[model samples]
Target: LEIQKKGNEWAVVLDSKYNRRIDANTKMEVSGAAKKEVLKDKKFAYGTFANCANGQTPWGTYISCEENFDDYFGSSDENLKFDENFKRYGFKTKSEYGWEKFDERFDLAKNLDEANRFGWIVEINPFDAKSTPIKKTALGRFKHENAEFIVEKDGLVIVYMGDDEIDEFIYKFVSKHKYVKGGDTSKILDEGTLYVGQFNGNVGDFRGSGKWIALEYGKNGLDESKGFKSQADILINTRLAA
Candidate 1:
């Protein structure tokens, strides 16, 4: 339904009305690009290659995550090959789908920088295919399997996500704003904080409910020196930032 690229910035295939592409020059406009002009770079999706693993959002939008990216491009080492990170999901180092052969951008080695943009949760509004899809980096950049939503009693937002690879972490993003019930989906989603979880408990903790900790920005023991410059920065490099 929707497609996207992840990196320090985010990009989406604008609905058919505003659809755009990111060549060697364009940057993406994912969530959290308020400052530093990180969203200026726009390399939109080429017609050739497309990513997968999509689900529908409550707001009539589609969420898609890119998996098994190494196969798209030529990787010099096996480390870059589909590592354990990709295994948790349903991907192998060798891609059965030969999209790369059709598009040069599909090749990871040729577009090494692009590789950083994959493995993210992309948001698409099928109703408006003209609008560009966006990569919500606040969700972290990994082999994402799902982005399911569960609203709390107070109308706060909570998105549950799985890494899909072995030993990968499950994460959630609790919104700072309450759900409008019928508000503009696109506008509301742009504002929220991303968080990762670490299930902790002794023998009992493992079996019972796992505590949910908010991966605060520069709080709860995050480095201040090389810390996230803005919410955009946090969303941009969520994987590395965590």
Candidate 2:
């Protein structure tokens, strides 16, 4: 995109500028049944807010987490019944911002599925000013505190994240594909497996052994019998899935 200034206005010169293909494409194909209905085939959502922490990827992009995002959405209906999933995420009848009173998107009664759209880890290309951020749903949605990226010797990328809420959980995402240097890195983030952490030691042990529990669907009790229908369901209801 070549730009020219003309009389206090900016205009594109109709020139060609190749944009990077780094978007994770997790927007339209996101999780949550009701939330999917609201975002069906849509490439974009509202936005990411309440992000207080940040991270950097090995590909030189920036990672911004959506922390305390649940505070912006709430139920307007006084008699609205909160489901277990909603309760697990701590959605209340009132919110800190009270956006539900004015914005339909923030009102749970009017748009209950909207809450599911938030609480994600958003990736941004700092080099591209015109680039749009992508919400990496494979990383599992929650009140993200921070994300640390690591590229192993085998070229696999691992992202360790922490949920800010007390007594919540710690999670890590391992990419299914390997990272190719200077190669196409667009979909590497979307193709991965998220895992939960489990400590195995005494209560007073300072250093304890731990294991990474895979949160994939169909494994263990994560099948439909336990109310998890798909990988999307496990990722969406990460707290319960853990």
Candidate 3:
């Protein structure tokens, strides 16, 4: 999508050479720890749609979030049961969009892990039309409302996000590497610490203090005993970890 100045006013350019659309069939790469665990070296992820809100990085890149993606895939088999993790993320037995009718990847019985590939913060370089968007799973996964960034004075990037649900929580991600001007920050999102918000004090207290709980592996019992192996598992099941 492109917007350009048309003499007197700005207009949306639908047919511009730089105009691009990423639908359900677009192919993308799943980077970071998720590539090793969830994808298991199958680096590719199919498409990124159902984008509701978005944010931008200081380096002029776009982060398109995948929300309500579970409505696109499913099956009707009564015996097709899902584990606690799948049910926790709200994967249903029938899809609203009925994408499974055409793409088998949408079918739970056909590709169980395919649904896990969505609901991530996808990064795209708006300046480069040929750039392949990366799915940053380390930021954690859920029905993300948006991801806004704040560059600290020390150059550390902090991403603030919300899960856009009534009883859900807010999250933040602090980049492990500081942002250097003119340097490639594309991979920065892939390496970060994700934290969930924990508000203290009474509900009506406007002066309440909030704490950011670290959702890292081996911390707070987020380990093998809890069915999580590494930081990747904690991120992939962020809602459960929170």
Q: Please report, in order, the local distance difference test score of every candidate based on alpha carbons.
A: 0.57, 0.79, 0.85
- Per residue, candidate 3 scores C-alpha lDDT tens digits across 1-242 of 78989788999888777788777777788877767676754757878887879999988899898888888878856479888778877888888888887788888888888888988989988877888888898888898889999999999999999987678999999999999989978678888888999988765656677899999999988999999988888888889999
Write model 1 residue lDDT over 90-117, tens digit each, in one string: 3333445654556555554454445556
Supply candidate 1's per-residue lDDT for 107.
Answer: 53
- In candidate 2, which residue ranges exceed 4 Å CA deviation? 1-38, 203-205
TM-score quality measure for candidate 1? 0.65
Local accuracy of candidate 2 as per-residue lDDT tens digits, 74-165? 78788889989999988898999998888787889998877877788888875665666777788888899999999999999999999998
The candidate that achieves the highest lDDT relative to the unseen native structure: 3
Deviation (Å) of 51 in candidate 1: 4.9
Provide the lDDT at 135 for model 1.
69
Per-candidate TM equals 0.65, 0.83, 0.94
Flag regions of model 1 displaced more than 4 Å: 1-29, 34-40, 43-52, 75-110, 224-236
